[model samples]
Target: MASVAINMDENSIRGDHIASSMIDSELHECVRQGNIDDFKSRVQTHSAENLVTPCGNTLLHVAVSYGSDKIIAYLTEECPSLITTQNSQKDTVLHLAAREGKDSYAIKSLVESNPSVLRMTNEKGNTPLHDAVIKGKKKLSIFLASTDPEVAYYNNKYGRSPLYLAVEKGNKKGILDDLLKSGASIPIKIEDGDALPKGKSPVHAAIERRDKDILVKIEKEKPELLRLSEKELGNSLHYASSIGFLEGVQFLLQKFQEGAYERDSEGNYPIHLACKSHSVDVVKEYLDKFPYPKEFLNNKGQNILHVAAENGKHRVVRYILAHQKSTLVKPLLNATDKDGNTPLHLAACYGQPLASFLLLLDNRVDRLIVNNKNSTPYDLAAEISRRAEEEYAKTDEMTAVERKQIDSKNSIPADEIKGKEADTNKIGGDYFGVVISLAILYFHACPKKSLFERFPVIKRPRPLRGEEMKSLLGNLLVAAVLVAGVTFAGAIQLPQLRDQRHELNSTSRNSSHENLLYGYLFLDLGALSTSLVAALMLLWATFNYPKFQIPAVVLSTAMVCLAIVMMFGAFFCSVKIALLGSHGGFLAVTIIVVAVMFFLYLASLVFPWIIPLSVNQILLQVVLHYYYYIYFFLFDYSKWWLTHKLYDLKTKFSCY
Candidate 1:
């Protein structure tokens, strides 16, 4: 039995039935094969001028996709209404044309016939321009955008405009510029009907893409574009600084300083944003131009310094300290954020050792200051310093091993040492003799019975004359002894101090020669300690005898010489140990010793008069240790475990 399907009238076909024969088999095949003459002949025979494919793809869609530009032109001219017709996916002929390489002619033909086609979108809501951009067809994209400025502004399913799509495809600077010049709104954000949540404006987009040239153009033409707000009223400057666009930031600052410090909806000024961004240049420029009031607090009673320190901008903090002519340093330094963290506290918690150091350097940096959490900067520094020491220790160990390997390969043999034994001992002897002669000369040079001492017959003028001279001579003697003792200790510790005659005799006889050199170097701790004690005693003597100010000065000079000798000896010992042992450990110990010695030297230089504020030291130590231990340890362990697990999983999966 034959089944019968109802057929609508010709009038119905003209209206709704246009799709019926329009997508007939013969026409569909003809259009797909780009048989323009056959397509026209069939259209004439069936009188289905508006024929579409079964999928609603018109003759144009098939023609464009197949690069049949001539057929597309003929069809578009014959059926102008088909120019707007979309296939099942809503992709118009223009969308298809923009996607196909040779469809530029078809696209031009469609645009020329019906300019409205430029605005048509496909099933994905992609306009011809969007498709052209996605396909990186620059010429087609430019033509579409130029056809209608709004074409450049149209967004697709992803809420990304033609400009946005162009950038995503890479090297789109030229196309983006063309779009922008063709009346694309720089401040308008591409969004869905409800508007994108904190949508990125064109300026924000440009800043993110690091398109400095476009940014400059936008700034020049629409300076106020920089003032447009994004998420939470964040302006272009906020985004620019956040992304570290130095040029964009500079331009914005220059424009804003001409007065754009108006409060945003969030009550934040550009300076606040700059501080939040921790951009040293941005902060400096703003502060330098329009100095904010010292009392000026953000909506949160937080000053600029507070923002800088919180963001861990050491240079910014230093700049603020030196430039901001406000007496608010004490308050700002001690001021606590909403979280109860003072600037110093934040710096420490954030592991900003340099910022913390600078903050503490300010005498006004509140030593007794505590954060909202009641944590002091010193508390942070202590931990940081410990971790620093640990890291240095590890590095020293590695370095020491490397050095030992090198030295082992390069060092001379015992026979070679014996050959030079005479020369070495002679040098040592000469050094010792020089020390003795210098000591004797120093002793005789004392003003005991000298010309000045003989003039003490005029004692009637001062009752303390004899005592004062005695004190001076005493201070001089102490200074001389301090110098001589330190020098003698160093000379005795020299590598060539041992007698060469004994070393040569032992080597010649092939005897079980005692390593007297090693014993002298290591076991003579008594003499070294005694000399150090004598130096300290002399320093103390100079400190006590204020009346003998001149002699005290001389004694202090001796102490200086002692310190120099000690420093040199310590350095040589450290180098020797580093070269002879595991380089890593040697380096670690050397760093620690050098650090301690530096502090000691500094203390000595400033002595009873100027002591380092302990609070600052404590703060630095805490920050270093906490960050290095807790933060870095967790990060490294997690990273290592994750990598290992991933590698194992890959191996297992591959085997399977």
Candidate 2:
């Protein structure tokens, strides 16, 4: 309801521009102070019953505002038109009486006098029905909506019908039910000049605000609105799916079949939206509750995986790949868009390493497949990586990891990330810098007048100068010493579960833990032994064995891989179930699983080059010079290739 104010002396209100056709201030005081007898006497003498304030509100409007029924009766009896006379808001006494309170007597009297006022609209284009319904004057609104044909399809300046506005209020009052059942339009259209409210629809607003009451009212009274896209170009399901409104999604789906298969103006289905919303739960809802229509492509011919992969939504991609019905597996895995790009192509083009990893792990996806541009996914990845490198090279050379770190910092809200932006600018590049530093070490181990160095024009790593070599040697020596210390500490820290045995020589306790004590002892000793051997090799190459530069570096890499594997093995063997409680046991299991995964990843990336060249695991004819001679290194030449059959080598090691 509009704000009502009474000025006894000067009848001027803020929003209501009343007229100044006044007779006496005393008569106005009679009306304002509720002196009905005095008002009657003054009006009989002065005949100010038809007089209006500056806001065009009659004395009866003031009477209604102050709940002075006697004054309203006196004024309306003198001039019956005053009952329908409007203030600046076009509000008749009937409008105010209906809205002020449950003054049904006053409302009934006014409505019986001038039934036209029930349909009269204010300046905001709201009829008395709108005011009653919107202000929670439930009984009056239902009565007006039933009797007034003008109220059936009436739209306010906001292009909202009585039904729409009632629902938009999100009130539990039966106004929505009354108006909805009173023949009001499902979705009221605008008149020639009126504009719709900013909200897309009543149901859209309800879902956007999560107003389940309004939604339930609409769903119960009119499920048609849930599936109706009308002028909004999208239904309630699209709005809910875009934000992962799972309850809304589930309700709409269970209520109607088209709700699950609904699409927006752009031809994006609910599953496509759910995928891009980054909500695995909503995606699961679509997969489990509805038909998993793998062939249902958007207008662009992109499937759910295409949407997920392009947005870096790895979890959604994983869920879709892992959870869909088996019959649809082929289409879901290999479906291509109009551009002839599969999900893998999109993942690679966007440089999502996790998405790429997940997609490649699925054997059904053809990584060698090319897009319309005649480029494979790996080619696309390399192309994007090169472009990123060049773009970053222009502005301080930010590598991908550093770029992500910077992006994460930048992605914070502007006010929250004050001095941190400039602080990041001073930090070094990430893993790429570590790689460059390692390459520098490899260069330092070479001869001063090496063939590549003799040709100064060659862009190969130049051998370190005498002073540079001294500094490099110092850093290497420090690293080697740290490695030796850590390996020795790891060896001594190995737990002996055998000493904690229940029986003197029970094999069950011993074998129950997978010979854990022996594995720990062997792994830790191997790490310690390999570390010392590599340290010796490093010292020899840094000082006098420049002639054996390539051989020493190969031996160092081989020992490093062996030492890493053995160190993990020692850590894995030490994680006994007895030492850790249930939760801790779960955590230990998780750790080992992650370690095994990372080990496999490392093997996939480095094994092609490392296994054949490793001093600890060299093969027969060509590379027998290293592995058999080094008992100090722990690696199996026989079992190295056994794991290779598990992995299909689509490319060499450096392809990554």
TM-score of 2: 0.51
Model 2 lDDT tens row, 1-656: 13343353235452233333564577668777889888877677544545777677677887887777777766666778787678887888777776775464655676777787776778887777777777888777777777764364566777666666777776647677776666544444445432233324667767877777677877776666676553443777777888888888878787765765666766788788888888888888887765556756887788888888766687787777776476655677777787777887666565444455567768777767777778665445434544454555534444468787887766767545533321211221232322222222122222234433322231223455455555555555565566668768866554445545443344665475546677777877887788678778867877785556546655665676667667766766676524433356667778778877876765554454554333322122113223222321233222333433333364354478
Please give each candidate's TM-score: 0.48, 0.51
- Residues 1-656 of candidate 1 have per-residue lDDT tens digits of 12222234545656665555566777667777778788778777654445666777766677777877667778777777777887788888777777774445666867888897887777787888888877877777678777777666565666666765654544463676566567555444533342222334566677787777766765665555566556544777766766566777777777654324555555556677677675667766665665544555666566777667655565578767765566634456677655565666555544454455567667776655655545455443333333454444544544567767867886989767644422211221122222222222222222234333322222122223445545654655565565456556655655544333244433532222233334334433433454455456555654676555544444454455445545444544434333332348767777767867874765554452233335334343334444443443365435644765796699799998
The alpha-carbon root-mean-square deviation between model 2 and the true structure, to one decimal in Å, is 16.4
Q: What CA RMSD would candidate 1 show?
A: 25.5
Pick the TM-score winner. Answer: 2
Question: RMSD for each model, in Å, please?
Answer: 25.5, 16.4
The lDDT values for all models are 0.58, 0.63
Q: Count the backbone clashes (under 3 Å) in each candidate.
A: 38, 10
Error of 2 at 504 (Å): 57
